[model samples]
Target: MNASKFGAEYALSDDMAEFPAGHTGAFEVPYPRSCCCSSGDADLLEAARTMREALQEVWLVMDALGAYQSDDDRLSILHSPKFSSAAYRVRTAMIKTQRVAI
Candidate 1:
């Protein structure tokens, strides 16, 4: 949950739907997500679609975080408005901790 873990195999859980026949990421998959296909005709295109959608969602969330540091030398986060709630919270906490320690 904290960015260390990823991948289809890590997603298998009780909440996950039953995997399609021969599709085993770890155990269950609602449709098809596993790369391991014993089936003669594995329409990985379905899995690709799923992956694409998930990636798009991640792109939007990361973009909102202002996580990207552009290469342009002139652009500066220092002059930018606070970009995300997460950043703001962490910054505030760090400042408070420093003040308390002093």
Candidate 2:
């Protein structure tokens, strides 16, 4: 894995003070392989691990955003039921993939 690809970009701002210095922007997520014909159990495990890791990054962002108090309605959208449901679906997928790998 390219560790640098998972790093968040930093920008200085007053609102940013609540967040960690280096954890402000989006990180790169791995693109799904177009073909998995040659993939083996190890590959599946690695893919599942990658998904879990990527989701963790998302959760970190969500947590940070949730901790932030803003009057912006757009920001509130992130905490909506629909968004929670979507995140739950992804968590379910990760769990299923991990189970299959095990």
Candidate 3:
């Protein structure tokens, strides 16, 4: 399911929207505008990329959890290997339908 299905309940609410056109060198889906680059160090830039990707990872996990909660089984995720793995992990963790011996 698309992330927008969650509406305005996102964690990074302000930074959630796409960067304004011309704000970055290019208006791309994965734009370079997400980073501040205070030191301009190569390692710092790499860290920013990793952090952004991690945020995306958690977003997909939340999305999958929402879909499963709504009982929408048709929401299929074909891309994003890490997201696919993380989604099921989050889905199973959040769901309380598992059997218990109590």
Candidate 4:
């Protein structure tokens, strides 16, 4: 996965700290335009919500994995029941999200 693609979602604001030295100007990130919700398209809204929840779950699991600093720690997490449960949910959510997206 491209880190830059995800970073595109983040925009530096006046409330945010200044960028480091040598930073130039800001460029507009390529954001996908949202669909019209007033059209009464329930399927689209459902798919969007599912995708968002799945992504959030994946993000949490990723943060948990980040706590493991060594191979042993990683192995322990790999064997954890919580890890397995999260993995299943993420996989299922991804499959559902993809189907609806198409």
Best by TM-score: 4
The parts of candidate 2 lying over 4 Å away from their true place are: 1-39, 42-57, 60-66, 71-75, 78-82
lDDT for every model? 0.47, 0.64, 0.51, 0.67
Best by lDDT: 4
What are the per-residue Cα lDDT tens digits for candidate 4 across 78-99? Answer: 7888677677877776776676
How well does each candidate superpose onto the true structure, as a TM-score? 0.26, 0.31, 0.30, 0.48
| Model 4 residue 56 lDDT score | 77
Q: For model 2, how many clashes? A: 0
Better of 2 and 3 by lDDT: 2
Please report, as a residue range, the 10-residue window in candidate 2 with the lowest summed lDDT: 1-10
User: lDDT by residue for model 2 over 4-98, one digit each (tens)?
Assistant: 67776544668767768566555869998776644566667666666776577567556656645575754666777756765775776676676
Q: Write the per-residue lDDT of candidate 3 for residues 1-102, one digit (tens) a residue.
A: 234865644343455346564453334576466646544455455554555665667776667657445444333343446567665655544342232111
Give the per-residue lDDT of model 1 (tens digit) for 1-102: 232555324445664457664554455538875656545324444444444555555455457447455644224433344324334544554454444322
- Pairwise lDDT winner, candidates 1 and 4: 4
Clashing pairs in 3: none
Q: Which pairs clash in the backbone of model 1?
A: 19-29
Better of 1 and 2 by TM-score: 2
